[model samples]
Target: MAKRFQIFLIVCLSISTVTFMLLWQGQKNNKDDIRALAQASAADACIQFTEYQTNGCESSYWYGVAAFRSFQQAYHSLTEGTNKAANYTFCNEVYGCLVLSPEISQSNISEIIETMSILSSDVEDENGYIRMSELRNSLTR
Candidate 1:
């Protein structure tokens, strides 16, 4: 009976420790993924801005869409786990943020990206969905 009790305690402690570590790592990864998203979008903004400068609004819009598609394609490559739906939702939120800003110019992309970085760092739920109910701007999409 004594040995059985000890075994049960050890098992419980081990599970608790592992669960804590996993949650901690998940939180850390959330931040890291958001940072990466900001960086990639910033790079895309530069090219898209160049397109806007050289060609026109239509050209820049298409270029921006393409670059954003690339970002979406690579986004999944950055993360892995049971939280894929959450990640997708988070990504869509950030994508909406990136596109529909009031000031969507070359000079403003950095500010937008920075805002995203700041917001994403703290927007995740315990389940990893970035359900930012209090966005600074109302998201129509």
Candidate 2:
């Protein structure tokens, strides 16, 4: 009877340990996913700014198409039970850039630059696409 009790306890302890590890790992992965979404969205802004500088408005427009998709991903990420307004701000600004991407031109680049600056300001998650400064710098150049 003593031996049986010890075996059952050990088995229960092992299962509990495994479950705990899986839960911890899931939490870590969620954080990584959040970071990745922000980074990709930031990249969308950078690409739009760069393309506008190099290719002109038309180039920006095409890239904006892609950026829109990227922003959507970022937006979806932000809304994933996180419901952060700052995060939505970041996504919306990028989405704005994408919306005008098709008509991108010297005339509008300046305005887009302004929007990017506002978006790059601060975020609920520090790991987000903190690259707005770089994007803004490119536009200013």
Candidate 3:
């Protein structure tokens, strides 16, 4: 009886240790994933700004697009529940840039992201082609 009890305690301890390690690792991975996602979105925004600059869109448009792209990941990261103060600052910066210009509206990015969020999941997830079409339609108007 004593030997069995000892063995049971050891097994429980090992399981607990493993569970804690897994949770810790999972959290670390989540942070890394959020950071990567933010960077990718920022890059995409930057590319759009570059396109606007080369295509003769007004400077305001360029600024707006560039600013939007720069902070997208941060905004999404926060919205997705990171809740870091740096994320709040990033959101402010992005919001400020959009608000500074009358040539473009914040709704453009909001609409774009709204569409993206919906289409990201298969049930409501609009594919890339569908998103592009929706974006183009938004742009035309």
Candidate 4:
């Protein structure tokens, strides 16, 4: 009976240790995945916005809306846990543009293109990843 109990305890501890290690690694990988998703989403937004510019809003209204929605989602995810005035301002501005008529929206194509250009650069830069890592570290601490 004593020998069986010892074996059981050893197996339980080994299993628990392995489980803990896997969970830790999975969490790290998840963070990396989300970061990549944010980057990719931003890039897609830029591409779609450029397409909207090329095709014009009269014909590509839906494309512009879709791109704007994607940009909003990606921006929100990337900026989570950080409070910055510029973030809110940019989001609100884009939201306003999204709600306008197609003719009005066409007039704002330049603004949308510029915004996407800036966002693309930001997401492509290491600073975006660093910011997310710092935020994660601060929370863990």
lDDT (CA) per prediction: 0.52, 0.55, 0.51, 0.58
Q: What is the lDDT, from 0 to 100, of the residue 49 in candidate 2?
A: 69
What lDDT does model 3 reach? Answer: 0.51
**Candidate 4 segments whose C-alpha is farther than 4 A from its true place:** 2-30, 57-59, 84-89, 100-102, 124-141
Residue-level lDDT tens digits of model 4 in 1-141: 999999999999999999999999878545555556655655666676677778754435566566556656665665566664355445545555556555565565565555555556665354443443332233233
Please state the error at residue 3 of candidate 1 in Å. Answer: 48
Best by TM-score: 4
Cα lDDT for residue 62, candidate 4: 66
TM-score of each: 0.37, 0.49, 0.40, 0.57
Of candidate 4, the 10-residue stretch with the lowest lDDT total is: 132-141
lDDT of 1 by residue, 1-141 (tens): 999999999999999999999999888666566546744653574567456555657667556645654554455554445456556555566556546653443334443334334433433323223332222233433
Q: Across residues 19-137, which tens digit of lDDT does each residue of candidate 2 receive? A: 99999988855655654565565456656766776676666656644654575565566566654655566555555544644343244555554444344343234434344333333
lDDT of 3 by residue, 1-141 (tens): 999999999999999999999999888556555545554554455445444545646663556455455445444553464344444453444445455643444346555454334323321122533553555455545
Residue 141 in candidate 2 has what lDDT? 42
Ranking by lDDT: 4, 2, 1, 3
Which is better, 2 or 3, measured by lDDT? 2
* Model 2 lDDT, full chain set: 0.55
